[model samples]
Structure formats: C-alpha cells, structure tokens
Target: MNVLSRLWTIAAERRNELVSGVSRKTNAVEAVEDLAAQLKDVDAAVVLIFASPHFDKDKLADALTQNFGATPVIGCTTAGEITPLGYETGTLTGVAFPRLHFRFSSRLITNLSRFSIDDGLRFCREFVSDFGETPGWNSLAILLTDGMCRQEEALLSAMEPGLAPIPILGGSAGDGLDFKQTFVLHEGKFHSDAALLTLLATNFRFTELRFDHFLPTEQRMVVTDADPGRRLVREINAEPAAVEYARAVGCSVDELSPFVFATRPTLVRVGGKYHVRAIQKVEPDDGLSFLCAIDEGLVMTVGQAQDIVAHLDREFTGLKAKHGQPTLVLGFDCMLRRLESELLKKYNAVSELLRQNRVIGFSTYGEQYHGMHVNQTFVGVAFFDPENEEETGGEREK
Candidate 1:
C-alpha cells in the first residue's frame, strides 16, 4: 500500500473506534443531547445506556430515540454508574459500538413474573436463529433484567442451554437502594416487568471476567423456616432469621442494615464454588429478605471481606498482562460491593483503579455469569484491539 493510502486507512480506523461518554445533566433531553453530541463522530451500530433512576424515564426514552436516529439503543436504570471518570451517581453514561467492528441483535422479554424455563429456552432459540452467525467474528450475549422481577435465576438457567458456547454475562437493573421498581429500556421505551437480551458479534479479542472480594468463613447456619417464593427466611437455626444472623455477625437485630449485609455477605456452595446470596433487608416480621433465591433446610455460611482495592489491582494487572491493555472494559459491578467500599473508606481508591483500567457500566442489583445469577460480584467483558495479526488468527480459531 502507498504511504498516503496507509495514512488514510489509519485515520478512518481511529474515527470508527469504540467510544464512551458520560453526562451529569439532570434533564433527560439535555443528557441525551450531550451523549449524542459526543458520539456523533462514530458510525455506531448500537448504543448502550446506563442512567440513574431519578431521571424521567419517558422523556429519556423519547430523547434517546430522537437524538440517535436509526441506531439501535438498549439499557437500564442503575444503582450507580461507572463512567470513564469512575464511579458516579445521578448521571447518564453510554458506550457506542462502531459498525466497523461490531453488529448487534436484541430481544425484549416482558411479563417476567410468568416467564418460565421453557419460555426462556424458546425465547433464546428464536433469538439465536434470527442472529445467525458471522465467520471470523467472536460473539457474546448480554442480559439486562428488571431487578425487582425476582425471576433472574430461572431466566438465566433456561437461557443457558440455548446460548451455549456464546458465553452470556450481564446484570439486573437497579433502582438505587430503594428496592422498588426497576426498568430495562428497549425500542425507545422503559418497561418495569421486562428484560432486554442482546447478541453482539465483534471482530475484536475479548475475555469474560468475574470476581468478588470475599472468602467463605466457617460460621454456618441452616434455614429451618423460610418462604422460598418471596425469598424470605423467617427462621435460621430454628430461631428468628434476623436475630440469628445478627448473632452470627456479632451485632444486634436492630443494627442489621444494608451496610452490615454488604460487609458480611451470606454464601452458598454450588459446583464447588461459593456464590454470594446477598441479604436485601430485614423484614417487618424479623425475617431476612434476600436478593436471590432461598429455600428451607439450605445451609449458608458467612463471608469475610478481603482487601477490595488490592484484589481489584491484581485482577486488572493480570488482565493487562494477558490481553495487552483492553480498549474498554464493559463492567457490571454489584451495588453491594459499592456499599462495602464506602463503608471501608476505599471508594476513592477503587474508583481510581476503575478509571485507570477503562471500566464503564453500572452498579447492578445482581450479576449473571455462566447461567448463574449471583450477588456481591463484579462481572464484565473486556474488549481488546484486533489489529494484531496473531491475535486475530487465534480468536478466529476459537
């Protein structure tokens, strides 16, 4: 290729790169406008947004549709936002995937309360049929669900078989700490009892990442009485659930709050791996309400907090060493982790590390990985440059 021609190609590639932007504007239209202006230069195939629950959902949806024109858009309300500048609140953040390296297809599942495993399987099968495949490109699926739907476990389990070999990962939408309504956006509208699933094909080297800074301790308790449907534990070790948990954590029942739950999470072992079954709040009946499923006669252990900053640094460093610095890290961090960080006074340090590592997304009510709906964990996908001939060849073979 001639020197001038090569220069032109490089410039074109740079303009079509993956891009992210953030806007703290409180008005929905202004926030959308700000984000649209920042992304106007790229030929975006799709744009994913993460906005605070405080915004007017209807106005935000309309503005997004009007500003982005024909580009597809999808996202959800967040407990908090992880922008390029790091952790933020009351803001709208987004990432634009350029058409030069990516393609997308989306499906919206509504009425989650009645969604069954069979329904999820059929839904995924149809989605995959429509998505088809692209040779020499890697594929991944992202699932965003209404956090309050309480159906993530069943939905994820069902979708797993159909999306096998595609590596699905995602998070449940949050309404901050209110634990009230949560919505997922699709087709220029926000629906509370719905989920948005997207399949993305990218000509970029990428990897899935999942981690949490907690270790299962020996302290154990048994759920002797529970309401599985509502995820309520009325009794533990045959005693009042909240009282027993407080005793286990060396605190009083009255002092049991979100921060305490964040610092001392409950874990369950599945497939030889411990996953956090986070507590949402203490119920009026003194039962312990959970963010995930609970069952009678289930054994649970308390988890001890580790050094989050150190653990995060190690994980990000290892990612860089293996992938040679990702262009962007699409992250789904659990809100409990954020609460724990604030309690430990390590929020700034963690935010700085996120900024340095190019992480962007939102703090979720829960996270999904490999068909499991988990809590108190950070789940993400890291996208690296595909320019290296060796790396491109390696990805194609996979």
Candidate 2:
C-alpha cells in the first residue's frame, strides 16, 4: 500500500551556539537510523553535516564519511548550521535518510578546467530532461564548485544559450577548515577543487526566483588596466582599485585586508545585467581579483541595492504563498554571506526563523542555481503540492 507519503517518521536534534556562530544537527542517522539504515531502503534523501576549524580535513572527512557513507552529500562549510533542535556550534552535524518516495540524481565533474561548456549544457539538458519524464516532477539544480574557481558565469553563460528556461541554484563549496579550499562529498569521498551537481525531481511546486539583494547603487567604474582574467590590478572608475572597494564598504586601504575582500565582496556587471561575480581576492600591487570570469573594459560598480535580509524575506514570503509551508528545504547559503549576516544585527533573528522552520542546509562560499554557480546568494527548493492538499507538515519530521 502507498503511504500517502506514508507512515511518516522523523529524526532531529540541535546543539545551539557551538562554535564560529555555527550550530550542529543530524537526523535519520541519530533518530531514524533504525528505520532508514539500509541505503537501498530509501527512495529520496537529504543530508546536513558540519565541520569545525578545530578539526582538520582528514578527521572531519573520516568522521562524516563514517556516518553518511551512502548518501550523495552536497553542502559547504558554514559559520554554523541550523536545525529544528536549535543551532549547532563548531561541530559536525549530519542527517541521513533511507526511506522516502520521490526522485533525485547527482553527477559531478572532477576538474572543471578540463570540462567544457558543451559538457555542462549536455549534463543539465540531460538531467532536467530525464526528470521531466517523471510523474509530477519539479526540477532544481544543486551545484557546488571549488570556491576558488572563477568559472561560474562563463559556465552558466555557456549553458544558457542552448537550454530551455531552466533556473539554476546552489553555491560555491568551502572546506570547514578554511576559506582557502572548498569541497563536495559523494559516495564517501570528500572532493577538493571540484564541482558536484544534484538534480532534484519531486511533485512539489516551487517559486519563481528573481535575482536581488544588490542594485547599482554606485556609478559603474571601468577597469582600464587588467590581466588575462580581466582583474583590475590598477584602477576602477579611474581610482586605485582598492579605493573604490574600500570607499563603498566604508573602510581605508591601509586598513583593508584579504579578510575584507571575503566578507564584503564587489560585483561586476557582465552580459548586460549584473551577475554576481564577487571579488575573491586582492592583489599586493593593489588590484582586485574575482572567483568568476571577468574581462577588462567591464564596468563594475560597488554594488548595493538591497540587503540580503530584505531580498530573502521577499523570496521566502513568495514561496510560502506559492506552495504554503514547504515540505523540504535544501539551502546553499554562502559562507561569506553567513559572516556578513553575523556582522549584521539581524543574524540571530534570521537563524531562528530557519530553525523554527526546520531548514537543513550548509554554508557555502558561493551558491549554485539551475545548473550554474553563483555567489552571495541563497539557493533552495521548498516542497509542496500545487493544489494545497492536506498540508502534511509531518513529512518534515526526521
């Protein structure tokens, strides 16, 4: 007998304020392990894991790999992780699933440098096409890349011209260890300098995402001098690159540092509209660099239109209206965005809302949408029936 999403069971726990403004949690494994222990027993899945700076890569990977070996894991390092139990600080929180009825597929490219745009479009087209064949299928792309890679825009650009109107979402991955390296986990392996793409298909209806959180607050600056990647190693809008960036965020070059670059990144408008190509690093010669493709002559502005909180509130409210309370939430929140959130006064209120809502996701360096990588964004999918049936909030249990 089909279960009407049936005989539902749940597993959830939270440890609040553990470390680095992070919280930890694990379900299925902790509470529902007895029910969903066999990987083959499950149909659809979700996972949440956290690693602290206190632990090194090997230990963190080994521990997580031990508990969540069979699941296709997609998450980024975070200042903290949120769960129904509360927030987990400086801990590795993991949740697993072995029984659920739905559809999902995950694929990865080991090295994007060798992978071409053709390969990307082919993958997205193929994945989405397959999901379309499923009954009641709604699609989303959960993409993760080595945060250091600056290929998101080019990659998305390459795929867009050919694919149907597919809205991609997900984030750049990070190693909980540091901002320097990011990783993705699949089949018990922790990948460094790689990208993971998860295509989800469920009967659940979703939201129509419009990019916001930033506006052209300042005049566009032309990058007169630059390198091959189009980095402005000399000036922006006719001023030292550092000056424009520091000026926008309200700081001084002497006081400006790499840490500043991470938390307060700038965006360059590419291909007519402003795509989120954030300044990933600053040069010693006083130039700025990016994590995605940028070309000289590209006019960039210190972007500032809306705060993320306002943008997100609008997005979430829209989702709630479209599908009511979500059945499942898979969030890719940028790690840098998490830091900016902490610096902002509303961080506590924001995390609490997610906690109360029972959202399970990891912090990322950047995010993925449809089939492309993006930064300073929150990419997610909320499950619900289009008709607003019985409002089965219990499916969110474990």
Candidate 3:
C-alpha cells in the first residue's frame, strides 16, 4: 500500500525569555529539546530541526538522543525557518512532517575526515545507484552537509557521476545569525563536522528540473588568477581586476563594489539563459577584483532583471494546479539571494510577491539540487498526491 507523508515544523529564537537567565546556549538547546519532545508524539519517520546561532550543539545533541532517536532527523542552522503558518526569525523553528506514512531512512557520514573527493563521489554514485534500483518507487535524495565543512563542493562533485540527473534537493544548514559555520541535525541531535543523507522512496513522480541563473555583465576578462575552491576571485583579463570592473560599471574603485554586485552583475550564458559568474571587486586604486573567475577573453553580458513575483507565483501556483496544493516546501536559498530579498521587502509589492512563496529553507553559502551548480536563488521541492487535487489550506511548512 502507498502511504502519504505528513509534515509539521516548530521553531524558537533566543529572546532572553526562552533562555531567561540561562546561557544563550542553554536556551537554544532547551528550545530544541522541547521541539524534539513535541515531534516525538507524532507518527513521523522524518524529524528535521534548524537551530539558532546561540544554540549549544552538545546539549542539542543530547536532547535529540533523549527522544525520537530513531526517526530520520536531519537539519542545520537557518537564516529563518518557514513554517506552514508564517515566517520565523532570530529563533529556532522546525518543520515536522509526521503522521502520514512514507518509506524513509537515514545515514550519517561522520568520517568526513576520511571523505575524499574521489571516495565521496563514489559513495554518492553508489547511494544513487542503490536508491535508483529500488523497485517501482519514485525516489529522490535529500542531502544536508556542514556549510563550514569545505568539502561540500567536492562531495557534490564526486556524487555528480552517479546523481548527475536525479535532481537532488537540499540546502546547506546555517546558524540564524552569521555565515560563519552551520551544521545539520540528525535523529533529533545536532551534527557538525558531519553530513546527513536522507533517501526518500515515495509513490509520487519526479519532475524535470530546468534552472539557469542571471546573465553576465559586460566586461571581457580572464581568470588570470583564481582560488576556485574558496569561491574567491583573483584577477580579471590579466589586469588588477578592479580596474576592469570600474571601467565596466563606471564605478570608482570602492569597498562597496562587492555589495553592489547583488544589483547589476555579469551573467554567463551557459545553454541559452544568463547566469551570474561573479561580482567585480573595487580596489583602493580604482582597480577591480572579481568574486568569480574571468579567464582572459571571456565574453560576458550584463544580466537583465526579471520580476520574480509573476514568475514565482506561477511556479507555486502551477504546482498547486497540477498537484492541487502542496503539503510541504523545502527551500534551499543562496545566501546572496537572501540578502537581495531583504531589498525586495522594502516595497509592499515586492514583499507580497516574495512572500507569496513562503518556502522554508536556510540560506546557504551554496545550494545543491539534482546535481548542478546554482547561486543567488531559491530551490525546492513540493510533495503532493498525484491523484489527489484537494487544496490543503491548513498545511504550512514545505
């Protein structure tokens, strides 16, 4: 018999009251424990938790160990966690999908120290191969990795061969406050220095994923120097980098060019659509440095802005049209885009347009989905009954 997956989420922030006179760390752990206990009473095979920056990982781990220790609990820190009802900020909130039944399982890769790029790739392929081989089950992979752990790209890279086309969906967990270091919570506990994998076998069908980022801005430059692994740009067109950028954007070399990138940046047309490669860095001498590589002679285009309200509304609406209303949404937003979204909120129209898609996801240093590179965007998946078209107005977290 095919079973349905029901989900719910709970969150808490360190508002001095939750912690009272206790340590900020203590309050976070307490919030997690309380949330965990609440989730335990439900019949969910999946338990995910996104804690706050002020949380105590050790205590949070103990709390998860105390209750609902068997369910597949996987999550990380978040800029904000989206619940079925509304958005939560500065506190820890969780989306718990329980009660409904679905085949689910979890595994943790604790030995990241031992996780080599080659080996990790092999593991991903193997994982996909094993999952793909499941009989008659439409399977998808939900992966969460330590954002601080430098191996995320390498890990995704390795898994590419195996998961190249499966459309893996997940986000890098972040602590609510900073881009410093974030982790994943598994089995009601916190996991840092580790990665969590959840392979879901569902009765629903997988959809085709087609995504492309912004177009490149004018400025032909080469990546004369680069630190690809670190996401740092070194040089452009064999110049100081900043100079070339200053010329392109007509901006005086300044510290804010990096910040200006969010609004007017270059795009690389990969297949047909434009995608952002990186931003130009303004130097003290009117020179520029780019955040992404600019190999010598690289042709670029200034990406045009496209209003997301209409696009996003249709995206979410179309899903509703096809699957009725989605029971859940799992968003993996790029940290850069989240910053841009803050700007979008200044206007009522933009705010409503953006919020129309209240996707619950943590801002990530980077995001992963079905095996491709994405930046400054929101990526997610919706769970709906293929045959059922009833609107779930009561459902909140996705």
lDDT of 3 by residue, 1-398 (tens): 22322222222111100110111224755676666654544556566666565666776667666655665656777666554333445555555554232456666778664578777767777776665544444666777887666566556666656566545777666665455767777765566778887776654433423333344544544555555555544466666666555556666555354346666666655566555654534445434344333444566565544554555566667666665654455667666555555666633443353345444455665567655544555667765543432321222112
Number of clashing pairs per prediction, in order: 0, 36, 50
**Candidate 3, position 170, lDDT:** 70
Error of 1 at 203 (Å): 1.4
The TM-score between candidate 2 and the true structure equals 0.73
Where in model 2 is the C-alpha error above 4 Å? 1-82, 85-89, 93-100, 123-132, 158-166, 208-212, 228-233, 247-251, 257-265, 268-275, 305-311, 370-373, 385-398
- Candidate achieving the largest lDDT: 1
**Runs of candidate 3 exceeding 4 Å displacement:** 1-26, 37-41, 85-87, 110-115, 129-135, 175-177, 187-189, 205-220, 255-259, 278-300, 308-311, 347-358, 386-398
Looking at model 3, report the run of 10 residues with the lowest lDDT sum: 14-23
lDDT of each: 0.91, 0.55, 0.55
Model 2 weakest 10-residue run by lDDT: 11-20
Per-residue error (Å), model 2, residue 3:
19
* Candidate 1 lDDT score at position 118: 89
TM-score for each model: 0.95, 0.73, 0.76
* Order of quality (TM-score): 1, 3, 2
